[model samples]
Target: MPRKAPSITHKRSRASKPKVTTGCLTCKVRRIKCDESKPHCNRCLRTGRNCDGYAPPLPRPTAITTQPTSTIAHLPSLSAVLISLPGTPSERHSFHFFLSHTAPQLRGLFESPFWSQHVLQACLREEAIWHAAVALGAVHGRFYAEGGEGGERQMWEGEGFAIKQYVKAISCLTRRGGGERRIDVALMACVLFTCFESLRGHHAPALVHLDNGVNLLLELQSLEKPRNLITQTYPPTPYTPLSALQALLTRLDTQATQLLPSRHTRLHPVSTPPTHYETFISLEEAQRASDELWNYCLYTLQPSYPSPYLHPQPQPSHDDLAHRQASYATALTTYLTTKPPRTAREQQAGHMLRLHTLVATLSLSTTSLPASEDVWDTHTPSFAAIVDLARRIIDLDTDVDIYAPETGRVGLDTGVLGPLYLTALRCRDPMVRREAVELLKKERRREGLWDSTLLAIVAERAVGIEEGGCKSELDTGRISDVDVVFDPEGCRAGVRFLLEGGRGSVEGHRGLVLTTDLPRGQNTY
Candidate 1:
């Protein structure tokens, strides 16, 4: 009883909480004590060495991983990362510009999380990301300021500040050393660089960066060999945004594939995509799969090997072609089974993907034609559906035209342009093709490497080449088909009118192109 009474009288002692001494990255590396000052420590400032900022890094967990050693500490919050952001007026201006104009333009019609969210967060956490972002913003402002057109080289080459910033971003990544997080940072820089080059009309560099990014990402996706255990990835901060990056890369990859000298895409592309796809978890997933399916379908159309030179590739055996075409049609049918999520934006995206799928499936039927334009006649209903879908898209984007007054609407996503242009170019139904062309003319923006203005012109001219620019039954699929060769390196589009235009001599239509050159390969659209 006496012991219990004494214990009951015991009281807890209260004292101040202990301070964290994890310190700045530089201090930790230098084996020096940090005073734990906010942002930059006084000790670091007094010394000559650069202060790498002072925010406690999230610990890297020893989790089961495809790349265990590649994992790294999580980045600090945007607020913390922003503390180290330079206070230069010009830098602040450009960063703000990127957040405002360029970022929105890069997103296109879809609400891309990669641009609207991940990019901003990554920019704060990584110095490389910040420089690249600022560079794009500055160049974007300069482009529009110079009236968007006219200054291809002037805006691109003359802007030393942006280029300098771009180089600095690369340098920062170089200094970041090795880790999966570092790779992620580098990939982010690649996306920015791709956009930067594309905006500057530097197609070669744009595709180069895009191809490298896509190939690298595809490699990572395919390379992942997960360990089976109690699964865990802590602060998977850098890991998850990759899905968004992949989606973005998918659209960029679609811009031009047939133009690539080697079929080094999707490195080990399956002989056929999965017989089925899971029900899409999101609109982004659906769009990516759709764009990929488009690539597959288009690939199936070509000879196993396509040559950039004038020499024609040997055609696959008729049976081989038939087998490939049948497989593609089945793939398209299977893809349609998986529907997109039902949010407003996703619903619209799903609508576009579904329309393109239907059109692709219907067009697959004509893979083996009887050397006649009449082959497309039976699919007039499907063609009408394509036009209707495109019309709906245009209606939704009424307040926003693909072509903006200043910088112009450029994006990596495959919007209404692909399906609509395909309908106009292939659909013999006068009304359907006319509707498609007209819609394209109104949208008037770039979609990846394909220019709507150029494509619309091509479709209009295709109608001319195929049917005297009309749906008249007299000159149908004349001369069989036309071969359009896009040599980005040569900066020339060679259109060979097959069987010579019946309505007008093929030579007469040679003068059909309205615009002289492409957007200098500096646009996502």
Candidate 2:
């Protein structure tokens, strides 16, 4: 009022520049500045490229808007504080799930803190690795949400985020101009990608990633061993040996094949058993030697070296089976006596070696027996050994949280299911066979990429078919050929029981047709 004579009208000028706290993925990929417009960025639209939606908004800048004062001198920049904000809330949940649940299952036999310590450290430091870890966590979270309300919807959403993070991680690792050069991290990513594919039942792509990871692992191992460097990009950090990881990968590669005999041949050729198999210094060396012996048995028993049979075949000759069995026995005895099971992993390893030994013994015992009714009788001791070992495996792993078929704890490939399934299939004693089948059905946890449900069904069908074969053949002590066909791609399996040695006539019947689909309301991981 005092200055009413000269009232001044002040108009606020528009801000000189608009804020750009986030950019579109397209713009980020192209390494160009974005206008940060809603829905579509003008720069991407002008460049004739599809505008991928903008990344989630980042925190605002922290430049002082008020007068600088002595009391507010040492506050850190807002960028520094927000840099550690991982991602969206969903992303943070996935990472926490991975840290708490998924990491334990993936540890397998080795309790090394590699996944918990080293891999997590890398994830926090590297964006690409961080995305990959989040992707894997999202995948595992789908399983954790089993049987809950709105679980299917959550699973679907998790799948979407998992795929998005996977793509972003791949993009960051493979960007053309300048991308991540951390080979070790890349290898870890490949393994995570393999696990993702395996969860989705896409074994072919999983195998591709496994192969790539194996190659990268070899490269990294060479670098670490010869140069004493952690990786090409990290020289100052001492290289931690990946022996346990290598073993885990090896087991994963082996489990993908349908049959045990078929699994080992796809990889490297079986090495001859060394002379010092009996004098191993450590449990690891003993396990390696036992594996070589196991491989030898598998290679020797394969229907064909290069072309393995999809269905079961007659056992090999006595001489052939015996030679392999002898080597296996020596390795087994040496391992049991020399390499005491000091840890859970070594105990598991020793149990596995025993199972392998039993399998080889069973095969050798029933070799060329013509599949007569007396086949089971003749292999009584071997079957008993299998039953004993299978029981041991079940008893040893009481830590597993066994749930209903609807929601079971998925686990790493323990090398137990294969042996357990073998026991269920070959052991015809009704009590033993049913017990084995019950174990398989109860152990609903997945092992690595191996679906426990599928294996259990296949084994159940095999046992049922073998048991329900022509009663005439069973009564007359006639021979019959049992063929078990497993199609990993379709998750379909069938068993054919054909009686052959019954009065020189062939009687064939389709015993069981097993086709598996993903559980209802479950998303493809």
How much does candidate 2 score in TM-score? Answer: 0.59
User: Candidate 2: which stretches are off by over 4 Å?
Assistant: 1-87, 112-118, 125-128, 147-157, 173-187, 200-205, 211-246, 258-264, 269-272, 279-282, 296-353, 360-377, 399-409, 469-525
lDDT of 2 by residue, 34-117 (tens): 888977888766645556564333443232121112211232322232334466766765665565456655765444445645
Judged by lDDT against the true structure, how good is candidate 1? 0.57
What CA RMSD would candidate 1 show? 19.0
For candidate 1, write residues 183-295 as lDDT tens digits.
56667788888887766545566777887776566445442335221022222446335556665666566555532323334422323444345455555555555655655
Backbone collisions counted per model: 11, 1
lDDT values, one for every candidate: 0.57, 0.54
Measured with C-alpha atoms, the lDDT of residue 9 in candidate 1 is 23
Question: Model 1, which residues run further than 4 Å from truth?
Answer: 1-87, 108-112, 142-164, 170-181, 217-242, 258-266, 269-285, 288-347, 368-374, 398-407, 468-525
